[model samples]
Target: MSTTYLNLARKWRSKNFDQIIGQQLSVRMIKNSLYLNHFFPVYLLAGQRGCGKTTTARVFAAAINCANLDAFQKNPRLTSLPCLSCESCKAMEQGNHPDFIEMDAASHTGVDNVRQIIEAASLLPLLGKKKVYLIDEAHMLSKAAFNAFLKILEEPPSSVLFMLATTDDQKIIDTVRSRCFQLFFRAIAQNDLRGLLVEICQKEEIGYDEQGLQLLIRETGGSARDALNLLEQVRFSSDQITEENVLRVLGCISDDQICTVLYHVFSKAKSPQKLIEYVDEIKLESFAPEIVWHRFIVALKIAVWYKYGVSSTGLVLTNDLKASIEAVPLSQAVRLFDFACQQEQLFLKTIDKHLFLSMFWIRLWSMVHNQEAEITSLVTSKSMVTASIDSKLTVTDQLVATSEQQRVTISANSSLWEMFLEQITQVDDQLIVSLFTQAKLKNYDTESNKLEVSFHKKFELFQDLFTKKDAPWFLLLQEVFGNGIQLNPVFESESIVQDVKPIEKKVVDQSKKQFYQSNNSANVSKKDIPLDISDKTAWAMTHALLERFPGTVTEFKEETDE
Candidate 1:
């Protein structure tokens, strides 16, 4: 209060609902609620940092608890907004109100701390009729603390009002969230911020360059508090606030420097070397790597936008930079931007910043070089292609036929299976090859013009694939051969084995032979049959038992006639 200077963010913080910016709809709804006397017991204000969640909460707390509201309510013509001169409003504004409680859950994030609030809610208001509890950063409350506070929030006393403000509303407990009415605050736009900054500068009588203010607007990323803080830094740096002064103070790159770096990246043949030189030059000027990287990314985006005729707002660039940016191809610009973003992620993870950045520039340069080489090779190949067409006419003539007219004649010596496998591997990898190779080539009937393929019972997956009319594999087979080739897929069925008389066993012991004969009497139970688990014929029965019965394996039998 004694200091000559007051920061713009603090001095301009909204004191009443009418002064709140960028949240017109939210503010209007809150005001309407007050006018209708339909105040909810608990209210939740959610938004990003510096978007005025806490500020709005404080103003709403003051308005609802203002002692003068009764008189204003009686006279409908008078303003229902909070009168700052009233006893309750002044106490709230000065942070001395006994009824208004502001608890920052970030520091006090325990069950016991929340218990204190629950205990205090039982007491009557000391100065005003309503007790306002403003819990900022409410998401930071511990789970146990939220559970303890949930009851009070769900059914608070009629004299109490709970206002919870948080940046991340999702972190708040669902039960607690459902009990409260929610309001969302949005970030202030660039134009709104610019107007506010211009007004502040005019009010403070501070000389500022228009471009310099624009830079501050972009740097702050639409946060009014951040913008004001940055403006204060720039205003303190020099007498006149100019773009160069702002860049110097903030350790940001200038537009010309950014353009110089990008132009060398796009126009110079040895881009990596040029980029290295420019980076060194910028470092010598004391530009931070992060700032340089941010500016470089912005410049690359401008190039992309310029190339595609898209607008790049809130950025003031020189005509030369715009021209150079517009000249780059959209694809190259996008690639460079994407590469920079990828490198930036890596840069954030590594401890060795210098080496990573150097390698990043080198990689970018190599990408450009590779693309240039590819383009050159494509052009060269196109020019030489016409010259070789006459020599390759015989080979080309056989391969270039319309789908309906093409007929591939296979030699008698050629193995159809080998040709099909070779063509399959070209289109797909080993996965598809493994799936198809299981099918046995039954026969290629030249007279019927059908390719008969038989699959084992275990290879039924291949049969299913071939049955699809529009599967890629089928189309690929037709393309490799001719459209006239018809595919006939067959699944070989398992045949039942008839009963065979058991061979006479060599009698080991008289008792053992008699016991075996009794167990295998004329009427033999299915479970009494000796199991041949190792035989391939028993696999299906074993699998069925394992799938149906799971763990119990009392008996396993071979295929038998029904």
Candidate 2:
């Protein structure tokens, strides 16, 4: 075969408005204007590559001055159908039209180049009723060139029509864009691209599997030109186009292999070694890690969509594969998807892709498995604790019923301390519970109504906090043991006194000074001090501040001056 043979993209170039793909809005607007013989002096068609902007402009140009345009004006539906036999239409098709001028603004971007077009716009057409100037990549024109052509582009001669096509509309100045009737083109749909590919294969007498054609459509990202070009390459390489051939040619992982990887990753019986084996198999098949990772995410997303009752047409997977993917919890699938995305950017920049991929899989596996194990352990522990607590409450209820016959006496030390722990647990005071766990009930006196507790050297810092005569801990202790009971906190080591001595005196002096000054007295004896409930409540509020503000209360004082 000679290289001179036309490629699929050129061979199947859209000749009329109806033949153009994925440009229905632009086509409808232009065709309606053509039908009414109402032409804009300047028209801007904008979109990405291979989206039919220039082709639509050319077709509209030929249709504007077609020999049989009268027939089209009579029937609105037939306006886009230009007569190919007309002299002007044939010239436009051959790229030799006298009335239809196509200028690539990319190459001719200077003011001199635009000036020529502006000068030519005043002349009369040699071959047709309207002279058309189609400028592709119009955004490439320089600022001076755009400024030079701005006047003529806004309001041109009666016989002249200007058509501009660009991939980026933002690059074009607003003043120039405002003057033109702008229409936007979009990417071709996968379904439409598939149908076009099928028609091309049928016409070219090429054999292609359904999956292979679908893969081509996906790889092209909805570009008709790109799909056709890929199709031509596949056809030239082999007589039969299969999934394996498409994967090999595109350097992508096959859908089956992708399904296999995800199945093992999310399966209940999944093991780390099994996942590693799958990665090795993919590596042996010459698949790039980045492509494999991308395919995994795509397949995982499709499964998630299906799980949520959304459309899953694009994905090609077996029933077993579908079931395996659906077995993954939605939360886990979402988390893995997020993690894979984070790793994707890193994978691209790393020098050792395979090593990076292996590390990523191992990290993901460990995190997922550890999370499942922790959740299971937490549930089991909660259930066991609930059962034990229920059994204990049953016995305590029976004991309470017999309280009149045999009074239940709560000991002032261990038994009362246990009750305090239970009360704080009921109130959800976890910080209090943690501190009490390290304390030891040393003694209790009935005559003086005093209770003493000992703490290890580590808890010496918090001893004075709980030892306050009206602290919340003392209140709870007195309520459980008896009213008027004082709490004496004892440290196990004398060295703790030195460590805590600096702040202890500061707190005592400030509290004593504040209390004495409030009574207008310098001396207040312990016997003369009335231990009223209201006074205890006030001290309790101060201790509450100690717990609230933490380290700041080492030397107690109010935060805001009121």
Candidate 3:
């Protein structure tokens, strides 16, 4: 006759407090309570699933009723308790202890079940000194059932001990929770979890790769049961556990594959067709779309972290892949991460997951491609200006030219002043050009060699670029116009009010009036102001809006009280 095979999770279930993994605090507290011989009438164990709450409860139950618990506690050197050799411990381990009753509150959530437990609790222990009731998923019990058992739970007989284990403690009534001695179990740490898996693999005679085990550890998400179950699945699928086999069994993409996709997306490639080809080549469609998206999100998040030099020890990336990810800008990585997160909700709701995923890849490629094109365009323009400046004059030549020009007095309205403005326009910086071009040459005193440049109040925030001596724009200005020229920057009202002719002002004021009237009138259509108006401030405002927004202006009615 053949014996039935047991899976790794059940085969390796924690038999005692010592065997329990990743819950040292709870185990120590329970053992300390056992040593003092002080037992709480009601004990509450709460945590996420598979973090050893239920296991610890069972161990505590067995230890309290063990025949040799007193002998084990008396010795300081022996840390292991429950004395598995004792008959009570053996019976509890075999699930045949009469004094120990284990209940699944999830199945028995009604008041009738609570009444039966209450009646059972009224009786004394048959096999041991103390009777223990271990309730798993205690949070699933209905409010009525909790109420029915509250009296017994609050003040159980001295011979009976009640242990309640739940993933969610909040669902349990506050009165019951207040009565119990609560112990929270935290999720297992990754290092401790990895050690556990390594030990299990060695004991089971399972061959494994480091990367394969790391993947298993990640997939487990700090659950020992999940880790063991996943390991069993991988072991049964293949004799030797490897990353390739893990991916095959899980039907998920590898980190390298994700890095490859990110590389192509962040690369100079314009089309996503290559990405589609690569996906088809890898047979990505065979993998679950949800899992693919989940991995993609996680990979992007890791890339963002790596880009910032954050310590990401668990991320298994090749050196080349790491370099590629680090090569991408932090802004781009953050944007991709944010976009992926935003699309996740939509992706889950989408029925055509494959189509949505393909489009997602395309959108990512488009974002990077468009951003790259813009950057390239800006760089090209700046590079051309830089080359022109470099070819025209050296730093020494520029100083000489400025000194020569300074010897001759130049008025604000003179041709020399226009040439100075033209020289500023030739500088490689766009912000300097934009600001200086918008500025009005307020005055130029030839005696003091002082140049007063005034800007509209709207542009006041940029005054530092011109006033600061160490600023790049200021240095460039000095290099071009000579160090003797003192630049005083000031903010004033629009130049139209101070400089425009009376007739032009009237025309602009009328145009503004008509603009506001059009916006206020619901029946009227939007009308374009005449381009011939010579109000530089108005034109500057219009040009700024057009350049910044790059769209047609639509009329919106202003609300008014009747």
Give TM per candidate: 0.64, 0.64, 0.66
- The per-residue C-alpha lDDT of model 2 at residue 404 equals 23
Ranking by TM-score: 3, 2, 1
Candidate 3 per-residue C-alpha lDDT over 270-296 given as tens digits, one digit per residue, 9 for 90 to 100: 346677788778777888888788888
Deviation from native of the Cα of residue 337 in model 2, angstroms: 2.3
Error of 2 at 103 (Å): 2.3
lDDT of 3: 0.77
Score each candidate by Cα lDDT: 0.73, 0.73, 0.77
lDDT of 2 by residue, 37-144 (tens): 888889999888887887788888888889878888897663447879888888887788888889999999999998888788889999999899999999999999
1 versus 3: better TM-score goes to: 3
Badly placed stretches (over 4 Å) of model 2 are: 1-4, 76-80, 288-290, 306-311, 316-329, 352-355, 371-562
Better of 2 and 3 by TM-score: 3
Consecutive 10-residue window with the lowest summed lDDT within model 2? 404-413
lDDT of 1 by residue, 1-562 (tens): 6865658888888898767778888888887777777799999999888878998899888888876666646663568578898898889877899999999999999999988988889999988878999999999999999999888888899999999999999999898999999998888888888888888899889899888888888887768888888888888888777898888888887877777766666653434545787778777347666877777788778777777777776355666666655554455567678778877887878886666766666666544443343333444565478558754445554445322122222222124456667768654334456556666566555446587766657656545456665766776666433355688877776532324676555644676878987666664434445544565344654654455357644454433334
Q: Distance from true position, residue 542, model 2, in Å?
A: 14
Q: The CA-based lDDT of model 2 is what?
A: 0.73
Number of the top-ranking candidate, with TM-score as the measure: 3
